[model samples]
Target chain A: MLRSQFHIELNNMHVELDKMCHLVIEAIDRCVEAFQNHDLELAQEIIRNDKAINDVERSVESKCLSLILKQQPVASDLRDVSTALKVVTDLERIGDQSADIAELILEMDEKDSYLMIEHIPSMARVAIEMVTSALSAFHEHDIQKANEVKKHDREMDQLFEEVKLELVQIVKENKDHVDLAIQFLMIAKYFERIGDHVVNICEWVEFNQTGKVNDTRLI
Target chain B: MENKIVAKNVNLHYGSKHALKNVSLDIKENAITAFIGPSGCGKSTFLKTLNRMNDYVENCKIEGTILLDGEDVYDEKVDTTVLRKKVGMVFQQPNPFPMSIYDNIAYGPRIHGIKNKRELDRIVEESLKAAALYDEVSDRLHTSALGLSGGQQQRLCIARALAVQPDVILLDEPTSALDPISTLKIEELLLDLKDKYTIAIVTHNMQQASRIADYTAFFLVGEMIEYGQTKDIFSIPKDKRTEDYITGRFG
Candidate 1:
């Protein structure tokens, strides 16, 4: 019942949430690196690390529940706890998408040439930055950085379109490798999805800061 | 808000001690409004002002308008008896009268002069049903109310309040003394009763307020710190002091 200890528990919740964020960030970085370098060993590592991401997300959620039951937080304190609750959901999905990308990378046969292989890496880099920047914004309460994540999302979307266009060109011209080009498109789609999850984390940060969720509009 | 009772800039004093300070809010009709705060923060004092329950305190002076149905309840011409009849109250302790259940419920209508045997019997049944106590105690109508469980006794108190057919009910910590299941039943009973009567309850149980109340007001140091829909109050309290109190940060 000590105020200091209640706050300590609250701080512990934040630390756990940050830990989950870092885990997902690592998954994104390594998943893309394994894909770019054609490193099947690293791809398998990311796929295995998916279970760890789920465990951290589950642990953060348990911590949130404990804080609510023990401390009964309200106002901004309550907001922070609930926001952390939501943040982990998107983080878990980002983790899953990374693993999905890695799984696809695992199944794809080695190819000397693939459509948009260079472009997909660019998308992955932007997506990784999005996740990394959004987590930093949330940890530091930086609205400007969160906004920048939203702005950068457009680039991720455009790169996805470019990959799709190049896939279509490959399918039209050299139908022999069309299936591998389709896998590249799927990877680009996963990277775009990772960007979307980062945007969601930014929106959750806005909710934590102002207690206003962007799920509705008042106009 | 379709308010049933309105307090406007209400102030109360216990001799020189300012007990309630410039409090104002509406108790919406057919909805439960909960007043929550720590001890001596004026939540209970303000709840009493709604039904003029504070009039019993010696040297208590009230200086504001409380209107029920657009009529100033504190007007010189307003009869306190009729006022009390229109606004019944349930207390913290399950203070069932040391009498049979039938008599405990019939006592209110008898004092109001409904002496016909069948009429009083019907009123007893109706009030008991309204309080969700009829099924449990109908067979033991003649048994002493003090013999019932603590939860039943509290519901009997609610039945006694309902017996008067009051338009508004003021409860002071009605479930603070009961177990979790009993507390849940009381909360369910309150939610059901709010459809027929406007309710204002003062409670220290934060979850109880959130569960049943449509609106909530947070009191602190004789001041109304925050007032809003229960969802807003719990999820996003505006004042730092209100936040502290709810978040268990305020001592």
Candidate 2:
């Protein structure tokens, strides 16, 4: 079981993956916080940190390539390395969507208070939890927990549809607040996409655990 | 594709050492099939069984059926010389006979009863051309085959096989002894040759098999572990042992 240098290198790669997860998690949290408070400075900060996530993504990729070439990993070990390659892309996309949500927040002119903004926070919370749980499932090699993360994405999707219906109601109820409702819908759409990325991460978790990228589990 | 040869439940033992275990496979016509595995895993032993090359070994006993064109090759009435002519083998080393280049290519034809000089010259030219060595060695037909480089000698060996007009060519690690450029040229030549003749190659190199073979059989510990399309074997092997071996995890 102790494969000397290869074992050590794979463990190190796992630690690097945790760091990538941390960066993505932070981006999601910051984007949600800035959107909730309508804080322009914090939104700009979320935009800036996407660069850090991109850097980690590239590093993880090259490290994976090195491990494959040097260690020639196979079977479960190969699946681990290959899934790491795939997971980083989904994680990187999560960071970009968070930044895009932040950018949209910057456009939604000052709304001191909004009626339909209630669901946005829960959608953000669900998206972040799905990502966190999916990463934990990957780290633990838990197929059941990964499947649970996929199930949580459906909740996020339902919340997305609910927000869309509410926005429609608001557009019909008051023409004055139509612009604000549309922005909320865009933010909800971004969160739903981020949740889909989380589902993709869970599917890749299945790939790492079983060496099968289950297409049926795909968003 | 039609099968050029079929091996059914073949087993071999060398003085109580079981070298092959129930090995059966169909070699498709005009396509290259590669046998890949670790050393002493019986890939070479099975390749020999195809042509009865194991008959000379002391204490070697074989149990199996090998059919070439639906004719039982192991039957007492079958002639090994005729079988070998149909199944020409190239070894791990560049083994050109100690003779002129023309003579080396002409050796098989002469053995098959071609005595005319003009006829021999034409076979020599055409065989060398078919082996992709004609341009380099055409002018040196009378020169010593031993005088050529290692790569040239191997190609001459191939040209020698081609002269026999064999239906199936067996290559045993043919490029293991050559340089990279020579290896690539031989690979290219084999690709061209497959359009006319069925070829079975035994190589330790997985990439070489993946690069050239249409079907690959993975052997291990004297057993045929997995056999399938080349892409499937390399990408998603059904057997754990095959996956482990191809991924360089198994010793």
Candidate 3:
């Protein structure tokens, strides 16, 4: 086969993979947004909307399998597709975690419980932003952005720590609000974890682009 | 095993297309060497060069020297017919002769001017035994070669090659048409035969190459990208292309 044909096939695969990653990131963003707004209806909608992400995951995985069995791609094209499949798996898990957080938010009846911490909303925002940027970096094959996202995971960890400490103080000050504070803390922890997972996805992308798994600490 | 065939800065071309680019490798005597790569990467073409099988194809040309026992096999005075007798080949498909099994094994010795009946019988027995098919087919030596099963047919072809008393054997995907048991038998035979004859095989199966090869050479787009011990090439190939290919990251 011609080299041009090979490149075209690989480029097409990468494009479709990027689109799937975008859908997963969008789902995660919506779930986090719904929880932060204390909108039970929106949170429930996000929780029920998980099937789209699942569909995308299955499609991307099968595409990678077909590429392997049919094209018998070699060298970098093989690494790229294999890593894309793994990264989508991480994205799927992130989507699941987002849905889980959304379900928890819908179960919590208290609306003002989220106002305890100024950092919790920022934490969610930063986490989603990290996820979105990491995926973008993967689509662009930007190693610098991948490394930057890994470094940003530390900020998400700091936000998680600060929010957890603040929530503990709030629970101690008023034992009546302990349950609500704990629930919000748990939500913050999930978002922080989502950030870490996205960073992992970025690391896989970097490895696909350049066959070296970056040694970045998760923090 | 000593180096029996050495290719230094060898380049091959088919008309305008370059098939091998400065490929340099040593085929050791009494050892099995595997050539592994995706199709159209010149692994099979490179294997054919060892015995000058490419001479049959028009417009195929080779540069540099291929030395067999310190003598240039491609020299003007070196007859390709005699070189082929020294380096026998087994192809992907079992191409057994239409004659009887005994005749198939005896054909090579007869072509080389061995006419004694006692010598022919000995050569057939020894060759079949060398291919690990002597006991299975010793009673059926008079049977037609085409009547055997696929695996048995492949073994028969191997025995036919062995009967020629070639110093080097070239197998190009020899077990590709056989079942798992047959593949294992051929692989085992290759391992055992390496102690007596120098062997070079080209295979698409990485697992098979890792399993049976002592030295492995990885090719990509007509270039010999990596050559080393089989374990090192499989576990940690020095080249990124080789690692990617072997690890199922690509073809």
**Model 2 chain A: worst 10 consecutive residues (lDDT sum):** A210-219
lDDT of 1 at B123: 94
Worst 10 residues of 1 chain B by lDDT: B242-251
DockQ of 3: 0.04
Instruction: Report lDDT (Cα) of residue A158, candidate 3.
Output: 93
lDDT of 1 by residue, B102-152 (tens): 999999999989989999999999999999999999999999999999999
Candidate 1: residue A113 Cα off by (Å):
7.4
| Best candidate, TM-score | 1
The digit string of per-residue lDDT tens for model 3 on B9-125 reads 989999999999999999888988999998999999999988889998899999988999999988999988789899999999999999999999999899999999999999999
Query: Clashes in each model (backbone N, CA, C under 3 Å)?
Result: 0, 0, 2
Backbone collision tally, model 2? 0
* Second chain TM-score, each model: 0.99, 0.99, 0.98
DockQ metric for all predictions: 0.47, 0.28, 0.04
List the candidates' TM-scores in order. Answer: 0.91, 0.87, 0.73
> Candidate 2: TM-score?
0.87
- How good is chain A of candidate 2, measured by TM-score? 0.90
